[model samples]
Target: MTIQVDENEQEPWTVLRISGELDLVTSPLIRRRVHAAVAGGRHDVVLDLSAVRFCDSSGVGVLVAARRLMRSCGGRLRLILPARGAEDGAHVNRVLAALGVRRLFEVYEDVPAALDERTAPLSA
Candidate 1:
């Protein structure tokens, strides 16, 4: 399956809602988009992966890279991984957890929480 990334602005955050399968073939698209957002001076990023159905190692790599990029620029990176059903980004959560990198990201249940400065990330 293919991947789709839709960009939106939520004040201090650039929200990228990604859906579909994230594998070796489609991971580069996400990487480029994150880089573009950073290059455009948008540091605070929120990756809404709640709609993603599948994730592979390459996709996880891109996420880690994005995290690094944000940190390098003194920016914040948040991930939206709703704890709803299995298909709603749970796969990515599982993948990240299995890889022992879930704690490396700040995760939220939704966009509002991710955007809220007073809110705390979900425990890894």
Candidate 2:
């Protein structure tokens, strides 16, 4: 399946809400979007992956790259990977955790929390 990335702004954050499968075929799209955001001088980014149904190694790579890019530019990157329901189980979250890179990012359960500067990230 394909991926969908919707861009929005919430004050200091540029939120990118992503949905659909995140695999080799679609990882580049995400990477481009993140790069575009940074190139536009919008450093603080929020990637809402709560709606992502499937993810593979390439997807994880994109996430890690995004984190690295944001850091290199002195920006912050946050993720929204809600614990959705029991069945869904936050697919991207599980993928990141399994890869041992989940803790490398500041993750939030929702967009509001991700956009809130005063809120803390969820424990990895």
Candidate 3:
């Protein structure tokens, strides 16, 4: 499947909803889109990965790099990952966990939660 990253703003956050598979071929597209968002002056970012069906190492690398970029700018980065039982568990979620990189991110179970400032992120 192809990847689609749409940049949108909701108050204080820039929501980037990513859909389709995220593998080596499509991951750089995602990375560039993310950099574009930040370069366009967006600091609070949320990656809505609920529609993602697969995530390879390249995808994970983009995620890690994005997190670092956000931190470097004193920006915020949140992620929407399916809960443990949803969609047999989100592909990116599993990939992050297996790679021991899940704890590096602020993950949420849904968009609403990720966007809500009052709601704390899920423990990694």
lDDT agreement with native, every candidate:
0.93, 0.90, 0.88
Q: Give the TM-score of candidate 2.
A: 0.94
Instruction: Report the C-alpha lDDT of model 1 over 52-113, residue by residue, as the tens digit.
Output: 99999999999999999999999999999966356467999998988999999999999999
Q: Say which candidate scores most in lDDT.
A: 1
User: Candidate 3's residue-wise lDDT over 40-79, tens digit each?
Assistant: 8888899999899899989999999999999999999999
Model 2 over residues 34-117: C-alpha lDDT tens digits?
Answer: 999999999999999988889999989999999999999999999999763435538888888878998899999899988878
lDDT at residue 65 of model 2 (Cα atoms)? 95
- lDDT-based ranking: 1, 2, 3
Better of 1 and 2 by lDDT: 1
Going through the candidates in order, what is the number of backbone clashes in each?
0, 0, 0
Which residue pairs of candidate 2 clash? Answer: none
